[model samples]
Target: MLAQIAEKASDPAGRKIHPREVERVFGALLASSEFWRVVALSRLPVETVAEIIKALIDVGLAVQENGALRLTPGGNARARARGIVPLIERTCPGCTGRGIDLRPYAELLDQFKELVQNRPNAILEYDQGYVTPETTVARLALLAAKGDLQDKELIILGDDDLVSIAAALSGLPRRVVVLEIDPRLTDFIQTLAGTHHLAIEVYRQDLRRRLPAELCRQFDTFLTDPPETIPALELFLTRGLAALKGPCCAGYFGLTYAESSLAEWLTIQQILAGKLKVVVTDIIHNFNEYVNWDYLLESVRKDLSFVQVSPRANWYFSSMYRIETLADYDQENRDRENLALYPGENLS
Candidate 1:
């Protein structure tokens, strides 16, 4: 049956009817509650999912049952054959907890991609990884939609993703500043800022150092893609928090379970909830995609060698954490011992 379906479609992979796609499409359905016959989609790119839905229906893997998509017996078999049977076993890190279709953002993706085409990928030693261009725009668009971005002062703690460029291009935020450890990124961003005449300021500052007085408490929102380790997350996140404008100010950071263990996440969460006293407003699941990180990630995951073919999936996903300050917050007074979290070694 699979053979026959493959023969009919010249672009089977293009249609999302291929093996890899089943997990995403069927998995979304499986995760939805029984009462919700019509489930909205998230995580997967919208364009690809459209073709997937059509193909699923055609192959009887999906059917219109009471104005909702219901998997047929054949669909169940296909899911199992694809090793996606226990769909909920490994919960979707992307939309694991939060649910609302991101379909509306789909329309603006290509335009966003065109805007950021010139930007480079992540650097491993810098502990940097970036989301897809569309995902970056989607994030800014989502923030704008949430009334968080318009004419707001934004400071990006680290922008390997170059999201500040997208924000500046959108002209939604009044000002965008980036504090990047990588000199290459600072120079490149400065070049782009000059070319596009975007209101972006770049500073080369290692996280281990004290933040500039100009940056302290100067922003309405802070965005960062920091290191995932406990000490690193603390140092980077605190720097981001320091850049925010007092109470009710927001901060956005991306963290991944693939790299950081549950204990690491808990300790970090406790810092935000206990010591930091900021309310975690939202955890947008699997919001960032790092396509170029495979070469860097293989060192950590060690599972990449098993893939005989280049991976087509966006397996490296990050949850976007939005924290809003509830009260007046003081910056951490970290001495020399605590400075080891930064990329470089400590000196005498």
Candidate 2:
């Protein structure tokens, strides 16, 4: 059964389908019948999960009913015979699996919510979607827990999530600077900062270009939620690394298995340890829950007839990574070429 599914699910881009991930897909089905729930629980890309589901249905192991997946009696028996079972819900309820409680930051959450109540809606061109305001506060809580917030000069590469505002509200970071391509976000953040007297600076900068000279090696911490493309991974991480003051300075970013495969995850992990010379201190799974983007209604995927269901909930999420520099890296000497620019291919 597994081999049949694996053969059918072989990625055209050559992404290997790991047996553990297949087990996870089965485990996710055992845990939930909703299609999106399975995608979220399996911690795989929605596209990959969709292919796996199609394969499962073709193999007569699973059936789709009203956007839910159900295993046949034979399939259920086979799963149990293979010792597969539902995932135990061991995460802390209060923290929502973030392992750090948000109760302590109640005031911060309140301020963040109120401030972003009329925040700019996400735009498709930028691949932008902001996390729920509470998720923003939770991210700030994690940063504070790691001692990366208070009295630290922070730089935010992208501000659609408006993390700069939340960090400023904490009255912790020594300074907050945002380099955002979206004028709507920049204007909104600047207005809020001026009205609230927050020490935040906004610049209309694009990450595709070089970092500003003055901003290089000037920050204590950096925050960004970059796109999952490999070029994006290198550009965002390298730029963030370049902005840090020295070793011990930290950077926080989000990556999702939905858009990035485990193979891509390996590449990112290698980049962090090898080229960037950073030590990964923490990786909190499902740490950021994005508000459903409005763009999905007209997205190409939404029109695909083969997909039996569409996302009914804010199921898109990403794991947060905190990396600290192992040694002072020469930002000027960093290599930009040879990064993966496409599926299974490295750029020259």
Candidate 1, residues 206-304: lDDT per residue as tens digits?
A: 878878888787889888777777777777778888778789888888877555544567888899888777888888776676665645434432321
Question: How does model 2 fare in lDDT?
Answer: 0.82
- TM values, all candidates: 0.68, 0.91
The residue-by-residue lDDT of candidate 2 on 1-348, one tens digit each, is 676687778664677776677778888889877777787888888777777877777788888776568888877987898899985557678888898888889998888888888888998777788898888889888888999988889999998999999999999889999999889999999999999988899999777667878898899999989867867877888889889999889999999977888888999988887777788899999899999886654653553233545667887889999998866563653444454433344446
Q: List the residue pairs that clash in candidate 1.
A: none
Each model's C-alpha lDDT?
0.66, 0.82
- Alpha carbon deviation, residue 9, candidate 2 (Å): 1.9
RMSD of candidate 2 to the true fold?
Answer: 3.2
On lDDT, the leading prediction is: 2
CA shift of 26, model 2, Å: 1.7
lDDT of 1 at 29: 59
